[model samples]
Target: MNSIGLLIEFNDGRVKEANFGMATAARGENRNLVALVADGPAEDAQAVLEAYGVARIVNIRSGNRSWDPARQAAAVAAAMQKLEIDSLIGLTSPSGRELLPRIAARLGAPLIMDCIDIDLEAHRVRTSQYSGKTIATIALTGSHFIYGMRANVVPALKEPAEAEIIDFSFDGYQDTGYEVIETRTDGSGAHYLAEADIIISGGRGLKRAENFKLLFDCARHMNASVGASRVAVDNGWVPYAMQVGQTGVKVNPKVYMAVGISGSVQHFAGMKTARMIIAINTDENAAIMANCDYFAVGDLFEILPELEKALAAAKRSKEVA
Candidate 1:
């Protein structure tokens, strides 16, 4: 059996939910699942990784500098080499996007990013191309492979196993001149769309930028991230960072609620992977209506207030309970 390495990502010291999805994707008939935790407490992730059938965990210690992507990549590459792992899998998150390519470069292996499906034994994978217009299947021609999966697309399933932990420290690491002196948040105090489990997006139908507050208010109660369509961003209703489309951020939330969006192909390409899609638009003939699992036809100006009130009431009820 070929050993498949899963690069684990942690948020606030807990295993990110998406790692389990990567773990699930790495499991196969002739694969031995291994988890790699760099600069984090591997023990903290053991129980969950075991639940996902990860039999081995490697805790790589290079230093306490979590922001050093080069150092982390070196450590991970060394561990994979020492373990003789055939393939390395990780989420196509911001950090993963930064680190995985470095590791692949160091190892001289082929790497594929934003992959939706992987067949390790066959050395083939599938990914979306041309803004979700086509699905492309690619075959790897290297001895080692690296895959960066889109977050939240693969479902995490339970497959219990007794895990064995190994601690690895790399002493041959050298600085690459790049230093992350300080990290700061954008101060929005909201999750990025890629990492958010629930996302509510606005579009041109909102009429103006201030109208987005309606989405923000509802999102606040639901603990969801807010996004915008290209039209909304182009109209200056929101910043480009909040845009979700082919030209913006891709999201794979559990629930994607599109408000006022016309369901253009570009916007759909970004969020089509969401497990559930709900659209609210005044036009019943909107393109989103046909693609969404559920849709409501009405004025969002009226619907948002009632929805916010309902969500707030539900929160109060749950708190009291």
Candidate 2:
């Protein structure tokens, strides 16, 4: 069986739960599962990675570099060569957008991004196309291939295995020439959008910026992230970071709840990979209604508040129990 490598991501010294799904995707009966980790303590992730079938953890040294994608990619590629990894899988996030392609290009390997399914034995993978309207099956011929999967769509079922950590230093890897100045944040706490399992989005149907509270309130109660359509952002009802469309962030969450959104192809393009989509619109003939798994034709003002109240009541009941 071929060796499978999963690029594990960490946040502030902790493992990102999203990588478990990537592990699950790469798992096979006779395959060897290796985790490629950097920046964070790989030991901290041993238990969780083993729970999802990782067999080994390769901890790579960063060489005191400060936020360089080129350096990071070089280290990852070097690790792959050292481990003799035949295939690699990772989650599609901000870092992946830069790292995965570079690694693939450096290794001269075939690469697929935002994939929903992969069959390593067949050298084929499945991804969404035409704004999530259909699935495209792509075949590849290569000695090694890297796949970037959408978050939460693949179930990370537990199949335990013990993991051994291997310390590797890739100091020979130098930067490929991309440099950054500095980074800033507005503290919006919206970074989870790219990795969220559940998201609730609003559009022009929301009417006003203050009215976004309706969506935010529901999202908070449900532990779901909030998103906005291009229309909503253009109208100044929400920031561009919250926008979901062809021009906005592409998301593939488990459950996407679109409220007051008029289901345009551009917007659906961003969330077409969602496992389940529920739309709310006043028009029965709205484009969103046709594309959604389920929909309710009603005034969002009434439905949103009612949903929030019901969610709050449910949470209270669970707490009491």
Candidate 3:
């Protein structure tokens, strides 16, 4: 079997150096895998990697004050060469966008980005593209192929595995000649929405920012995340982070609850992958009803609070059980 290396994202904005444990778990097989932990301490990151079934880990320290994509890429390429990796897998985050291309260029390998799924067959690998709207089954013409996995698409798995941590240091790389003078991280907690199992979203009929609290309360009761339509964001009723549309964040949760949303095409683009969609609106002819797995025709203000109370009572009953 070919070796697969997974590049992980550390909380410190560096790549976590470790093997692809989730892939191993999903496949029920083990391969030569190496993880690269960038920027953060390897020991802390190793715990998460170990849970995923990584066999070995390679920790790389760039010794730079800020995250330099080029430098990180150089480190990853060096590790890949040392490990003799047959394929490389990375998260399709902002850093991956910059690093994967550089690593592919340095290694002279085919790069596939934003892969939603992958299949390993006899002597070949396959993957999907274009937000899963299109499928491109690829046959690796070369010995090595690099893939960037879309975040939240692949289910992360945990399996106990012995992980050996190795430290590596790098030097003598071309400086991209760029400096990050100031860095400020967005404190919005909306990132959880991307990985959420369930999402509850609101639209223009939500009326005002204060009304959004109902959505949030319902979401909390269900242990779900809150989202909003682009119209709500544009109207200043919600933050841009909560917006779900073509211009906003894309989500593929197991269940989606859309409240008072008219279901514009742009809004549907962001959440159409939801396994089940439930829509609530006063107008029975609202566009959302047509696409919903379930629909309720009524005033949102009346329905939302009742739903919240019902869910809350259910939670309390479960706890008492």
Candidate 4:
């Protein structure tokens, strides 16, 4: 029987929501499920991993507490080898993107990244190509495979399992060559744009920097992430980190709300894969109108405040109920 290993990621000492989706992709008949935690403790995550069909959790400790991608990848590869895991699955996150490839190179395994779906039984995976213009199914012929799943593409399904936690110490490579100088955050106060389920982005039509507060206020009430068009960033209305475009961050949110955006090709390339798109622009002939699922021609300044109030009221009502 083959075992599937899930590379669990953590943010602020808790499991990221996308790991559950990766666990869902790892599920199959006649296959054992294992979760691997490299950067943090695994005991607190055992219960949640169990709910996602993970029967065993491996906590990898390198003994040297340092941020070294090379060492961490070697440790993960070693753990997989010890457990005889035939497949390793992880999210296409910043850490996973850097870590998975190194592990693949170390283990000499066939690697696939940004996969939207995985068929464990058939050793096949589905990916979006040409900026989601087409879907491609690729077959893996190797006995061992490393796959990076796109965040939130696979909905997490609850499959209860009795899980056991194991501690694994790997002294394979212990060179703390890299030291962290500083960490920078986007400071959006919401979820990361790439990982958010819903996103609301502003563009040049927002006029000035202060107007971005409307976007932030509405985002807070919706529990969604905020993004900005390249024009908005270039005009100094928002930071470059908030930019969503071909040259900026690519997002795959469930719903992408474009406010006062003209939807240039570069901007569309980043968010075209969103499941649903809603556009609000003053021009009916705006390029975003044709590409979006829904659109409303209006002044965002007037519309946004009302939208924020309505969302806040609904949230308070839900909490009261």
Q: Which portions of model 4 miss their true places by more than 4 Å?
A: 174-190
Query: What are the models' TM-scores?
Result: 0.92, 0.94, 0.82, 0.93
How far is 172's C-alpha from truth in model 4 (Å)?
1.1
Per-residue lDDT tens digits of candidate 4, residues 1-321? 678999998887789998988888788888789999896769989888889999999999966576667788989999999989879998888888789999998888888888888888777899877755678999988768999988988888999998988899998775647656556765745467888899999998999999999999999898899999999999999888889978887898999999999999889878988999999999999999999899999999999999999999999999999
Error of 4 at 9 (Å): 1.1
- lDDT (10s digit) by residue, model 2, range 1-321: 678989888876677888887888788878999999865578888998899988899988866446677777788888888889978888888888888998898889999888888898898999887777789999978888999888776777888999999998878865555676666668775756878888999998898999999998998888899999998999998888888878888887889999989888899889877889999999899898998899999999999999999999998898899
Q: Rate the local accuracy (lDDT) of all candidates.
A: 0.91, 0.86, 0.74, 0.88
Write the residue-wise lDDT of candidate 3 on 1-321 in tens digits: 546777767644433322232354234354655666655577776666776766677777765747777788888887778778767777655577788998888888888765555554433434434433546766555666777765556555567677899887777577778666676767754545555678999998899999999998888878899999988999999888788767777777889999989998788877887889999998888889998899999999999999999999999999999
In terms of lDDT, the best-performing candidate is 1
**Per-candidate RMSD, Å:** 2.0, 1.8, 3.6, 1.9
Tell how far residue 244 is off in model 3, in angstroms: 2.1
Ranking under lDDT, best-scoring first? Answer: 1, 4, 2, 3
**Candidate 1: tens digits of C-alpha lDDT, residues 97-160:** 8899999999999999999899888889999988888899999988789999988778889999
- Score residue 153 of candidate 1 by CA lDDT: 71
